[model samples]
Target: MNDNLYEIFHNVYEYKDKDTNNHFLLTENLAPGNKVYDEKLIRIQNREFRTWNPFKSKLAAAIKCNLKHFAFCENSIVLYLGAATGTTASHISDICRRGMVYCVEFSSYAMQSLVSVCEKRTNMIPILADARKVEEYLAIGKVDIIYQDVAQPDQIRILKINSQAFLKSGGIAYLCLKARSVDVRKSNSRIFKEATQELEKDFEILEKIDISRYEKDHMFYVLRYG
Candidate 1:
């Protein structure tokens, strides 16, 4: 379990940030007669497209590490940054069953497709806006967790802004860092270290993993507000 989480952390950050398309939201190959889901809204071939938490995937590395501490409850609001096309965000919506999942996305092009898919559901809320400019809409309220999956060059800076304005103190956060987006010339460790330093200033980092086994080029970080 420890090894898997570490590998996933790296995998999620190694890929170049790109717009995603064609991937099924929550449809992954699972066991027969062992489907696990809450209330099903949409079905394909009589099977549900949701019901997958980290407990069943390489992305599950984040939960195993207890970085964001999402598994313990099904009732906290999560402010998701960079909800491109709502891929992983959809899975989060499944896990957060009773809670609200607010997806904050930027690309108007991506939002066009994402909004169409999201409007079909009730739990997920799509906000087409810049993550860096979170304060503008943060008046909504504090969030229990903030998931940062943006691909900007200044990932840490934007994260800090959201943490300050939206995240309630004592809440948790997950940072899915893409190495290519941060710095391709230096070693991945160096970039990770730099971001950790910035976060440690105000957060209590729980775990930092490689996660390369699940994602091609990426890293996943879990932190708790101090």
Candidate 2:
């Protein structure tokens, strides 16, 4: 079952039990072959997620599964950690037109292309730093969402720190965690379960889907502060 933006946020029943939406009408349209991927993203970064590996970021799978849950109002502030090469980040920037995107990438290797991408795009502030030291960027606080796509073992811990420091009271977040990154010996389900437990302490988990066909043994979990 593909989860659109609305289903991710509104239909989860964690926030509310009723399925008020018609499932036909859509406010945030992120359908494949839509203008979002074609016209807008190309205009902004001059490229989208073609050359860069989707194996790295899970947004493509998120879009494939229905990207509606990612919908946010205009002018929203998004904190993106592990923004490699600015490919997926470019797509997000296009979707969130008129919004502020604060991207944090630790590797200088990807930053080479990312810097060039950011030079042309506005509202994309690229901060080269380890996400563990997220306190450094908390000065620019109260973001609408925090997107964590890191390949580290302690991602949940870092996201909690960043969310407490930067995310607004009712803000949302997305975590694209590599289960193998945390525990290679354990099964994918085991790793995901542990990570989910860690995340449930602060936020309400809207959906936890297996994203192995499009990617690897990774899971894209949509969360929000309760």
Candidate 3:
């Protein structure tokens, strides 16, 4: 892994390691090869980099499952909802090196940690506000992407509201659907069906990937706003 052998896979660099079949995100290693929220770093090309653990991030899990779309890119403006402590948000920031990540989190306690992560990356912004209230961040204007990982029953509704306010037309969105959060008793497939039905009204469902291996009872949705 230290040979610096790297390949770009949908805006993320993958390490050529014959030891394991796991996929990883190539980060600039903002921190030393230490654990940031339980994520590890691997050195490649003589550059210290962090390994994007799939179990810790749905976006990483989707890539592990062969997701085709590369939604985020350099200089891409992104609106991230439910950015708890900036775990996945950090990886996104790594991919969008020249871009900005507007992280919206309601918990003040979590925002504190997120701010620490932002200090290391100039492009990352930490906002303490509820995702349901889009007006709070209306000044951010339109963004290229909207990523929502909120664990609420009305996650789809919340995403729709934020997309309408901040996301530009033709923008991409990655939503982590936690079936258990929506309904504890309903079948996972049935919950997904119901959510898709609601989301189809505003955005086109690009791809629905099962990420249960990393996050139990979860599905990752790739959407394109019309």
Candidate 4:
């Protein structure tokens, strides 16, 4: 409700500091006083908002880079792959307060931190499993959106497999492709092109964003599962 605070997307907001002229992307804090990854919290009109750091999250970076499609809603179920420490997932949790975010992570070390964050944010569910193994977490059922940030040679294949298993028809998917993970020798453009081509086989590319300013050699793809 602050005059400086503007809602950009559903539950997402932008706050501008008058004196400093610094703009920050924020989400209404779902856990009120809880802080995830030490992000700054602000209070406006009796509502708490958590600053979403674009430097720390590819999804936030994509939003900064003018990402057009935001399919996430207050009750949209999300399957978040490679949810390390639940930074972005927590923000998504704030957006989808009534829905669920199945946080799938491979590293046990990361899962420990993710679990702690999930505990504070009731909407986020921590799943300790590799993203490549979709069957391991099939009980999550169909989701409205799939957000993949896995770094692997088979990232495209992993997204396709998971989309087939969990994403409902016409559901949205956000793929954060790391070019170097696919092949160190290949150019970033080549890697992104190949990944896009593979994804086009089963999904429609809605938007392609270059998040290299925050994440080098990364191309963020917004796709709709067919």
- In the range 67-157, model 2's lDDT, one tens digit per residue, is 5566454577899999887656765664566787888999999888777777666767888888999667766778998888888988889
Residues 109-207, candidate 3, lDDT per residue (tens digit)?
998999889888878899999999998889888999999999999899999999889888999999999999999999999999999999899999999
Go through the candidates in order and give each one's C-alpha lDDT: 0.65, 0.68, 0.85, 0.93
Alpha-carbon deviation at 179 in model 2, angstroms = 0.4
Candidate 4 achieves a global lDDT of 0.93
Candidate 4 residue lDDT tens string, 1-226: 6889999999999999888999999999999999988799888889999999999999899999998999999999999999999999999999999999999999999999999899888799999999888889999999999999988999999999999999999999999999999999999988888888888899999999999999998999999999
Each prediction's RMSD to truth:
9.4, 8.8, 2.2, 0.8
Candidate 4 wrong stretches, greater than 4 Å = none
User: How do all the candidates rank in terms of TM-score, highest first?
Assistant: 4, 3, 2, 1
Q: Candidate 2 or 3, higher TM-score?
A: 3
Tens-digit lDDT track of model 1 for 1-226: 2211112221221111134522222432122232333412334445433433343343454544444444323676889898877666666665566677888888998787667656665567889789888765775688888888887789988888898898888888888887778888988778887888888999998878776655545678778886
TM-scores of the models, in the order given: 0.72, 0.75, 0.91, 0.98
Which residue pairs collide, candidate 4? none
lDDT of 2 at 38: 23
The superposed Cα distance between candidate 4 and the true structure at residue 187, in angstroms, equals 0.6
